[model samples]
Target chain A: ALAAPALAQANPEVRWRFQSSFPRNLDVLFGTAERIASRVAALTDNRFRISVFPAGEIVPGLQVLDAVQAGTIEAGHTASYWYIGKEPGFAFFTCMPFGLNTRQLTAWLRHGGGNQLGDQLFADYSIQAFPAGDTGAQMGGWFRNEIRSQQDVQGLKFRISGLAGQVFQRMGAAPTLIAPADIYPALERGTIDATEFTGPHDDERLGFFRVARFYYAPGWFEPAARLHMMTNKRAYDALPDAYKAAIQVACAEADSEMTSRYDHLNPIALRRLVAAGAQLRFFPREMMQAAWTANEALMADLAGQNPRFRALWDSYRPYRNELFQWFRVSENSYDNFAFPAAAAAAR
Target chain B: ALAAPALAQANPEVRWRFQSSFPRNLDVLFGTAERIASRVAALTDNRFRISVFPAGEIVPGLQVLDAVQAGTIEAGHTASYWYIGKEPGFAFFTCMPFGLNTRQLTAWLRHGGGNQLGDQLFADYSIQAFPAGDTGAQMGGWFRNEIRSQQDVQGLKFRISGLAGQVFQRMGAAPTLIAPADIYPALERGTIDATEFTGPHDDERLGFFRVARFYYAPGWFEPAARLHMMTNKRAYDALPDAYKAAIQVACAEADSEMTSRYDHLNPIALRRLVAAGAQLRFFPREMMQAAWTANEALMADLAGQNPRFRALWDSYRPYRNELFQWFRVSENSYDNFAFPAAAAAAR
Candidate 1:
């Protein structure tokens, strides 16, 4: 314990328990929690150790943030978007519908002062937060029936999480909050007409394609989803500087790992889902328009009610609008010509 | 499916089934497979889609190459190092003990003609391969007890995956093969005295710190572990040009996503781990030397036996040596002084 004495003299090791909102099945989210724990331990040399519990182990998955704030758990891994039920502004810390992609989200957090704003927001909840993982641009939820027009979305019962639900609900869909585990059964039993569970790999694993054959394209609701690691503010401030650095390094690493994993697995899983007789469908023009309008209205209401929401909306909306126009001009134009033609020639 | 008809006219929709040698639990590896499928689908519209299966669903986790070769699956995602058990030379394709980090491996593969060499070697197995994911440099392994001298490692049963197992075997440590799910239990039961799984995030999730208090540093065996996406040569070559292009683009995207994700998630995970009671332990001087020497011997054996391994060894060894010296002059020295004191102050 030669180094122990030195570590002890500098800072005392603190033991903590971290609860995760997602199950171990979603590696990016669950793995983020695991990654933070390891880095903190390494940096602090065992003086500080954190035990991680999967969603159901400590508290109900959805209640992780509340548990952390209440100090029932010292820390938590979840999406800031999940807390929108408590405050609509919380979604900005995670991501927004039809908003930034992974790169832009990171840029906003790291360079555009999003991190500072996020820290400030969490401070009110007695928590310290960091951007831990992003699921890039996600796909639209899977559907049991093909959505051919705006009318098709009316009265649709969909299982969607976070702020996306509010937007969908405004479009006249019954947006139900279903856990990832419960999604499969709900979709299977006709409890949900559509559901979104990340990209193809996860959707396929949960057998969404088995019961629901109509898979949709473009996850307009969750353009980029950011997962977070939140610690008790007091606990985080007590971390040794070395441990904090390690946590930073580890979170950065998690960002990379999560993106790469999604990039690789989503393709193969999509292919299988399609091959297994699941029909891939796209939202009609009218449907997309309606949803976007609904999303905007919901955001406006959220901002009107909360100052933090207003602050983030001021920055986020303009950035997204600018990005949307740019992507439409270049990426959309080039991809349309190159891909569809290429697909035809391949056949 | 309005877009599908146009896409079909340009390039026919092709479907592929990919089996992964990883569970979605290991996000980076499995996620790469997911990204490839999604990117290909987006590029080709609905014309090209690939479905993915986890390691155990179609076959055992480690037999990704066999499945690809047999054409039971069109493609697979796995670490090339996992196949060292089949051919000692395969380790260089994935990584070598004390070998290249992320940058060096990327340089070797993309610019240094390592990919060409990899293709030539995989040709014998009737496979086409691409670099899918990289876990940069890794931590050594979690040890149950502190390592004092070379003798401390002798006769120890260590659960290690990939080519590092060979190097440890040479050092008189009995290297055991344990699946990711099984690592914690193996370590807890004292069936293995040490184990390594990526960096902190993953190691922390497996709860290695709970049982093994002594966490070691510097993952010499896997400085950069690169995963590969392999396809049966015939299956790949038979694809239409457009499908081929889609696959290539998809692979490239997966490559980027895997690394980016790692960068994001690792930080917060580390801090949480530290607060959990895990102790960080560095390897003693003598043990490191023994392992390094053993690695050299293993490398020499592979070079002598496999021509492709020899080619890679010729190119990689020198590059690694040069990089090490460079890092020593820059990164290593700066980090050593900066980290410890900074860590102390933060504490």
Candidate 2:
């Protein structure tokens, strides 16, 4: 009880600017940046702080990685797959077509050597990335019309990002990368007939139901999309041990909190969206099969063209394979039984 | 860099003794306590430290809540369900028969006012609880003989903790609450016919496979078992604001880390166990359905007998039902497709 404030004599005041690739409208995505900054401030007793900027406040939405790498911002929060143009291997750090669920992805990152592979790629860019958040499984997208089969996908104009765009293109859909702020307008104007931008909570915020009535399930392209806090390596390495620990702890909290928020909010949001006339539908087997074929081919091409992609794929695919088998054992068995059972009980 | 080491001058040194309900052998469980302490020390610049004692060091394994409540230990790490004798509602905080999965439970805790409900329960005991860790879905248990139906479970002695014992008792199994340390001895000596400890990682460590070859899937009674850090409220309220923030951050890390540990370790451990001649079997639908019926009756009876149980159940059941409905949409679709695809492709 005799403790007095040491007045932070040993704690150097430090400040960093953080940019989010998401617009401020998406609270779960953009809010995670604020949460991380706030936790760091609290843990460090205000000696260390971070200021957050939404997309376009500094660099445009998709330029977060470039800004962080160039030290224009000390850190950036963005999805890893958005930088597949920089290196296809970057996709593994985020999510891949037919990849891990939320828990499986985090497990891989924390224990299955995922961070090492991701770090190896990030180091080349003068960046160190931490898995800061996840959006669980994204709804496939909102379509103006139902996608029934492979034929329906042909020549479809889709606003999609990451390597999923490449796979859609392979399946004969014309895919374009649109920033989050731009997706609603593109869909409304019919410039893009469909758009996939996170799940029900965010989609509801964007009022996608008003513009696109046909909502699809299972974003196969992004089963569990993870976001990263990309820090400028020089800036990160210079931090004291305690500051480093603060960032690690804060980022991990954001990592857990994001999905928790989505899980809590999405159900309520989905119900509202449905009430507002968003007709829910599942992608047909033929289309999913075609998309799967396309994804496989596109990934193979990426691996053949990019050595780093191959290296990450080598680490990621086998772990995914083995984890899937185990999940199908206990985790899957439980969910397959329990979710339906709960739903039925409520009925 | 004008900072001098002002830590000793400004910070008050504080220390606390912590106890774990788990033994040191279960690293993922007890190791979480150590991780929390380490993270706190690093964040607080070694000014605040907690020394951890394993179960039986201070009090027996199941006496952790009592120790924290009585201030015998400043803090304790244990599961909530172990103290169901005090309140059947505590089982909802840990897990329940046909309860939420790992993500669903955490989601409820974080966003669905689960923490408030739990805190209301703990406040009576002069304790504060924070969810610190999770072991995804547990495998049903290690059984000497396969449980093919309701008939197979009649008079079977099972070493299971929690209200699950009550549920099993309703299903005609004689269930005993045994500490983690005593479970192996009970199983080995034929004192218990079956035991459901955690999933593969802890079960494998305990050598349950050596004595019980018939391992079961889908731990229905505990789809996801969560652990908590229970701190004496008197001790917690006296901490510095920064110290409170440090513990919150560290516990969140452990919350995320525990599932990651299980997800990463379970797959490998499962493979090893199966290769060592362990038989993996799914609980027959007949048995699962019968167990569900038994669980429903037991829960209803508890709700009738205890107002607190009814209060917690009132909050939990609806959130779970709604979450399950939402999960069956995108999450189920993705996992149902991706997991099986990955497994088949591996073959």
Candidate 3:
């Protein structure tokens, strides 16, 4: 109703540094940081600009939580799982073996009780978090020995992470931690029988297929992993509501783009990997059954002793189970019937 | 960069009317329009505002596209398939039977060639489209007489929409078009043997369970139906880049929220419906197989006759196929094993 002159208010310039756990070369991972920075700048007409720095520039890749908490940077972009050692409950925000997939986990965070539960944990560190991106279901691993049955995993030396490592230990595999750069050499030297990384895009870059012949499907351990933008609570709360709103909008786009990009690019990348002699196989049924059994036991055991983990798990598990039922009724049927029929038609 | 005085520019008072095809009663569908309007206004500090109107206040529910195109309204919230009779190519923007689910279709629009193909189709209508929301696969239908086999569908009278209607016709059901308000009465009087609606939340509101005993799974035709924000191209082009960015950001939020809200709300509603005596069932194997066959034939038939529809189908079908294969390898296995095991554990 009023003229522009009457409503005009001064736009304040706000600048902050955002550090990413991922390096610049991994476009889908690190690119989400760049996306948030640019979108925020555009949304606010450059009034609020966030400068993004890759891992190791300011802090080590996995130290993003510490950096954000210590206020070494205004914000940090990293997977929640990287700091699970800091709080075992943090794994719920990324994903777990047999956890909710992309949409399910996202629905949990955004709409279910997961976000509130997660923030309860984040508040302890004086950081505010928002989902910035997701890596869709990844490849399980590249294996030198294909596990045709549950017996094959017994005493197998596997290179994997902690939560999944515990599950593998339940299934009788000795899980060993190896750095990403060391994975290829380890596989070649027979120091690791199998190794898991990100999806085909990053895996192809790592050239794991050259040493490990059998590449498995469904990345059960990480059904779909999410990355977050962790803003120092002090920095985030000081922003004018409009600038804060801009951050919310921009972050939503990143939350969506990161996973959608993988969905788009991974298939094309997987084809290249297959053409280069990567053998795609489903993890044998017996191994998957054993892994599922172990996964449940591990969660129950963690819930029994860690009350904080129990608080998050209480919501995460029930929500996970409910969606599991819903997706099975809808998506599972659609994918099951549609994929084979379409593939058959093409053939 | 210059100081505050130089960069400060007026945010002009801009307003537009947004009409929604869905009624206010379907909160999730109509609520997205309200969300976008508020978000845009907030992002621009009330300088830009979109006034939302429910259907029938300005035009009938399905007239959104025409109103937006003819400039009677600046924008519309409607499913693209609502106007397929105006142009068959419109169906590709919405889901098709056995086509891509929510994430798969969304990825195509955001990253694959889909947005280009869709924009080409929309350009002719003088409308710019953005995905505003999605309904994760609808329930198959409420059946007065259950479809236990392929032959069970023969001569069955089903109140359903066009594309799926054609497939049902191929499967020998006499597809009838009845208004939503008339559907239940028709089924009650045996004028229709079954009726299709949205997922459990909306269906529960319609009280379909009172008349139809069997509610089925996997709405194959609308595996994940997307609703779009269709803006008049002329009105849209006149906006500043900042305003455009605001629309992009707000629509993304709506796109995520609408489906997630359903995912959050549906399971609770479904559990209630079951307690209210709704008999849940899967469409039998034979019926699903026959429906898939009919669906493929119908798509091919449309492709044969309508060159514009053919143009979109070529991109849509292959992309759908690619994602179907990818999802089957990941989500399918996870859901199949997890849903049953979790369900059994709960029991």
Candidate 4:
């Protein structure tokens, strides 16, 4: 421990502030940012320290991109989809309805030309984004009533985000965007009939099951949502290579750590939720099919309307198509057979 | 760059050698060790440097564990299952027939008590183990003939490894463990009728498609094969906290990098294999079912006979069973719906 302070004294100490889009209450999500900071500090022997601020502490949650872009903060931890209003292409970096799952998304981002394309996109906003965390496939929002078919969605108000919200709207549901903090009150007061937020672990913390008994399966809207650490481009460029490497490595660990935490915690939370009277049900096949149809149409329309979206879709669509083929043959086959057998044996 | 040399002068220089249980030609697999070394060097300002030696350079591939444990090499990169003959519990740290996939295995190892359990087991050998890389779900072996049923596997000479070999033998196949370099020659000369290696990228590199043209789907055996970096306990404990942190971070990056690289490259290799006349086929449902049955029986017998195996199995099985339920609801549902649609649209 004495070695750390000595090393810090030998080097000029660097400090940066990180603003997280999530509140501290969602520790698992927000903790990813803290993990990155602490890891960097530890790796650099305390010469580099990053202070993390939760949502509204520095800038409002949704203004993370704005703050980062304007260099008001050195960095921000937030989902890329939150900035879809600035550019629809932003959604691909986070997730899309019926898009790639976590593993697939990571592969695409790191290897399948996504990182470069993402950098090119973010360069427009004077930010450099690094994948920091993932919320493995979210659940379909908690529902106040059983949704048996596409008709059940008619005139229903659902809180969702990104293109999935558009798909829901196209299917006759009134899709609303609400902050994470407001979701519980909205669902309770019937201000929104249902809400989808992250997965079982985060959702349980929000007490969604208490208000809506029917916990749905398969969040088709945002399959695998990725969180990013956005650094001000000028600030990032000025850092020494070692500092840059520290940030990169820390972000990679944070990415894996958050996903693993979710995978471990979500099951425990789901089991507890069930024991406490939450009914787990699959979104009806009819509804799923309808959403898929709407998603395809919406994607086609977006591609037609936005060149940036088209450029990204052209690359991503084929890569995803190829990935799906491989995954279906590999992951899906194994899971489809093994999971059911394991479930049966447990029963 | 001047800062790097100055930093090095301020710290004691450390150099270590890493022995890899993989050939240099198989860069994707072997490169993980090199990646760790370079990343550590970059992070440590060259105060610490690790030289990587490929299989046969320092010790034979299978002798990696022995060399690391005996302190003949400071560190090693190899698959844990390669040492199952030393203790069958070692197989849990790698992969089993129908074991956890990459993400699930990672979750189990990192967050679900696997790291601690692995350390306890490795401590007995005076080695410290860190997961360094993963080959995401491998493909079923390249076959000389289509396996239409369980009968098709009967008496067939199959090149496989780990517990899967035992399972195959129980299923009436003559399972042989052939070195990766010899697999292609064995398949070509009719010495072995089938061979399962890492995945498409490695298989294509080994030119399995040239001889066996019937490339199979879904490697039920060794779904997610993990590569480990093992260090002598004393050597690891003697390192400063900063150096230890550097190794851990480098290993984490390597783990994610290897998996992402495989995911990116496998699809490309599979497409090329198909174009070059490799017929892609799924292992028959009957055969998969038989393998599952054999796997269960083998696990039971091993648990009954070995206490360590039982202890690890007791922790892993329940975790896996629960993981299956959650994945079935989340990942599988999305893939089942999205994949076929994507494939059809592509066609």
DockQ of each: 0.01, 0.66, 0.62, 0.55
Q: Between prediction 2 and prediction 3, which has the larger TM-score?
A: 2
What would the per-residue lDDT of candidate 3 be over residues B1-347, giving only the tens digit for each residue? 43233233436678999999877888888899999999998788788889999987798878889999999999999888877789877877877887788888889889888888888889999999998999888888899877778888999998886488889999998998776777878889999899988888888888889999898887887888888999999999998777898998899888878888888888888888889888888888778888888888888899999998888888888787777777776667666666787788778
Name every residue pair that clashes in candidate 2.
A6-B10, A10-B6
Model 4 chain B: worst 10 consecutive residues (lDDT sum): B1-10
Which segments of candidate 3 are over 4 A away from where they belong? A1-10, B1-10
Candidate 2, residues B103-218: lDDT per residue as tens digits?
A: 99999998998999999999999998899999988999999998878799999999998888988898888998777777888889999999999899899999999999999998
- Please identify which of the two predictions, 1 or 3, would achieve the higher DockQ against the true structure: 3
Clashing pairs in 3: none
What does candidate 1's lDDT look like per residue over A1-347, in tens digits?
Answer: 01122222344556899998988877656876887676555433344678989998989998988998999998888888788777777888777776665655665676456788888888999998877777766667788888888888789998887788888888888888877888888888897788887777677777887888887767766667888888888877876654454455456556655655555455556667778988866667577667767877887888888888899888776555443333232222222222232233325
Predicted candidate 4: interface RMSD? 3.6
State each candidate's clash count: 96, 2, 0, 0
* Candidate 2 or 1, higher lDDT: 2
lDDT of 2: 0.89
lDDT order of candidates, best first? 2, 4, 3, 1
How close is every model to the real structure, measured as TM-score?
Answer: 0.51, 0.97, 0.96, 0.96
**TM-score for chain B of all predictions:** 0.90, 0.96, 0.95, 0.96
TM-score, cand. 4 vs. native: 0.96
Off by over 4 Å in 2: A1-9, B1-10
